[model samples]
Target: MARMIPDNEAKEILVLYYSQHGATRQMAQLIARGVEQAGLTARLRTVPPVSATCEATAPAIPDSGAPYATHADLEECIGIAVGSPTRFGNMTAAMKYFWDGTSPLWMKHALAGKPAALFTSTGTLHGGQEATLLTMMVPLLHHGMVLVGLPYSEPELTSTQSGGTPYGASHHAGVAGELPISEHERKLCIALGKRLALTARRLNA
Candidate 1:
């Protein structure tokens, strides 16, 4: 069995996500940066892409970016920020798959009362950004997590033509996936992470 992390160890905010074509991954990195800016450690982790073939499997360790998340990561985290690209108005299969397998954590109430946040990226301007963010909250809610969202006070929510929303931070990557994250979107993402971290800290304090 894997050893459990000690409660006395430094607290971490788990930045968990799955990205395809890298847009969502970029957002994840920005959120992690925000988490650190708030003076907490951000443990970046990703879920492996799901393959159609049942027998096919990813290598135990990813070749780059964040390491694959473990149950321990979820259980030991002070808060969580989850992200994924839009998949028909919902989180990607890979992200959903990861949460689906966390029944053990649910059974133990491992995530109950912890603060959680969400983010997403989409290919087009109307491509279900808010829907995906809302749906992403379902699993977190099932885990009994306290939901956190971007409030309108964060000016980006009112001004962004791209993908900043009150539900959570988002990015409009364009249909060709050619566009970079906009300045407003970036600020909202960072703000969301910092907010989540601050909430976790106060709750634990």
Candidate 2:
């Protein structure tokens, strides 16, 4: 465990993400497991995909994986782990759309002082993993959440040749997004999640 689990532990860390090819979604699942490893509950959630046609709509509930997140999830979670598939050196439009609807929480400072972490998956090794992660942090910063990231102290950070960064966890999903996460990349994802959850526990304790 990253830290001693409080006897009265009640708060959870929200593991929210948008995935196109299931790679980012897998990362979110691993992150949530890591959060639970650190003794805090993890709330797995997802955002629906967007469409070019304004008239198109997503179902009220997702068909599989996790349920769609609500503003209440943001308000209730002690911390958050956000993930997205990189899109042209930035976050996906679906993920952005989710944040765009969070103005009400922003106004209430609902996420202020909470800890947040980021994760991303890209089709190639040089597909803007860092840029996507950095840009993803912008809105969380506006919400006044503390940012958490993997440090070099994590052995995988120094040894991993595939995907890992101080900015956040990352995965190389191949051009077709068919690659499974590498061993080192998986460890880093879990590490980042534990780090974020530990921070949340400390602050909330």
Candidate 3:
């Protein structure tokens, strides 16, 4: 497959996610902003939703939003930040489906030693935000990725009533999924990206 990104640059960080109602998408954009602020390029990519029909397939190009993520994206980026709306305290099936096909990369250790971070959005304040974040780390660990997470020094971790955690950045959307991302949650998302980018840069250097 052709490269989605230019070959010269090795400073790009991949922001990969699957969003159902836009909350996670917003968070992904904010994270990208942070990554840019830290002097790295952010390659925003999304996975196509998994369909129930065995033969159903997505178009080569997405109708809107970021283009679908390719394994090449995972291999090309120096770092990655993964996001998803929580599903029963775990990543959405679509997100899981994307990672499930990455065994080829795992075999090659393509992502080993790369920095990775996680972010998640939930339908309720008590929904599985932290659990989703923790579970998301499993695949990255399998690939030998160095996990990056929010530190207590961010302040938002202690102050945020909505959603912020040491596990990773998180947002507590209301039951209707209408609540805006809280200020603390937004800041933490950006911080996570910045921290991940900085870590990746240092490791790459």
Candidate 4:
């Protein structure tokens, strides 16, 4: 039997997300933990809240928790795992708005060939968790990223009653975002992160 050799030059993986009610943030942290478990560093980042008014702007820095993501962060990461709460069966406007600003990086092909994964939290079991994950991958695909998804081989996908999908990890947060992440959902999240990191490391090598 051959022993596996780990990549020695793996770049940091970025776990970026936007959460209106904090559920998605918790999922991001769990994914980050999974990435670290795979022996890769995780750089967590969040986007600023969007405003309905045309002239409104967020402060230069967030009040607490992860800092706002920048183009530089995207450029430097080797792998990326993005998460957002489902909004009308798609990613939130804040996350969409953030990706809209990445044209420069796209043009430069800064993210080409990198490994990327998606995750989401929804208000209900049928609240389009899979659609949100698929939709979130569009921009990343346009940027030429390699999409990483959870496989059916993961037992949680077959057994989970709440939220776990082949598209990516998901959580059912209920209408008020009051539901706790189920045991299966958490395991799936960690699995997604670990798989993503391992894939990125191999590809980078």
Candidate 5:
């Protein structure tokens, strides 16, 4: 049976991502903070690592931190914020694999009309952060979610030297995660989350 999210309960926002070196994870948390700031519940979830040689199974539950995202998480959330580190100007294979498995939900229109946003981190200044963010949106678009992006009106979009784009929020992690997220990048992430949550609430109403 398909799980149902109760109308009476507070709207839930799912912050899902696959972080290789923790920078993406930090971005997810920052986004979650913004979701909470908008008075919505944020459920943080992560995807398991994928194997290249053969099909591998992760334990039913993760060893620590957020549980691996189940299809139910996508169905239960009124909004979604997805993040990943750039892999040759695209989302990592692990993250892409997770989305590829969501065809069932896509067919069911489970996420239709929900508010969604994307984020990404890159190793260098020109390391395809925007392309990565844009590519990540493809699957979400197929699922019928509304794409929310940072608008040029956000002052940081104009002032940001490290990472900020109209496509979505982003961070330049530098080589080996040496660089911290800039003030502009952090604020933009929070803003994206808040915008998604607020949009979800308004849509639900």
Candidate 6:
């Protein structure tokens, strides 16, 4: 079992996500940066990609990027920021699968009342960015997490032609995932991280 720790000592927020083709992963890193900018630790974690064969399984440890997330990470963190690429106006199967395994946490009310945030990446501007974000909120809501979204006061929400939304931070990757993260999208991502970190801090305080 993981060692017990008081909430006062859990001064970090979790930036948990799953990325394919790397766009969502880049956004996750930016969010983690923003979280640190808010003066709290950001615990970066990722879920293993799901495979078709029930016989197939990922190695216990990932070869690179953030480590595979553990339930303890969720239990210890004061807040959470989850991300994933769009999958038909909803979260990817991998992200949904990971959340599905958290029934134990839900039974414990482990995430209730904690601050939560969301982000996503899509292949096209009209590719269900808002829908994915909104749907992503369902599981968090079921966990009784308090959702936080971007407010229009953030100037980029009004100006970004690419990908900044009041729903949450987002990025518009090209069809082949060739386009780089735009300045506006990057700003919104960082802003989200900062906001999530700040909210987690206050909740813990």
lDDT value for candidate 2? 0.89
Could you give candidate 6's per-residue lDDT for residues 1-205 as a string of tens digits?
A: 2223365574888999998899999999999999999998899999988876422157889988899998888988888999999999999888888898899999888888888999999999899999999999999999999888898988988999998888899999988899899999999999999999888777665
Tens-place lDDT digits, model 3, residues 1-205:
2123344666799999998899999999999999999999999999888776532267879899999999999998989999999999999888998999999998888898888999999988889888899999999999999999999999989999999999888998888888999899999999999999999888866
In model 2, how large is the Cα lDDT of residue 17?
Answer: 95
Model 2 stretches astray by more than 4 angstroms: 1-9, 53-56
lDDT of each: 0.89, 0.89, 0.90, 0.89, 0.89, 0.89
Candidate 4 lDDT score at position 117: 94
Off by over 4 Å in 5: 1-7, 54-58
| Stretches of candidate 3 exceeding 4 Å from the true structure | 1-8, 53-57
Encode model 5's per-residue lDDT on 153-176: one tens digit a residue: 889999999998899899999999
TM-score of every model versus the real structure:
0.94, 0.94, 0.93, 0.93, 0.94, 0.94
Per-residue lDDT of 121-155 in model 2, one digit per residue for the tens? Answer: 99989999999999999999998988999999999
Q: For model 1, which pairs clash?
A: none
1-205: candidate 1 lDDT, tens digit per residue: 1123455789899999988899999999999999999999999999988875422257879998899999988988899999999999999888888888999988888888899999999999999999999999999888899989999899988998899988889999988789999999999999999999999887887
- CA lDDT, candidate 4, residue 205: 63
Query: What's model 3's overall lDDT?
Result: 0.90
Stretches of model 4 off by over 4 angstroms after superposition: 1-10, 53-57
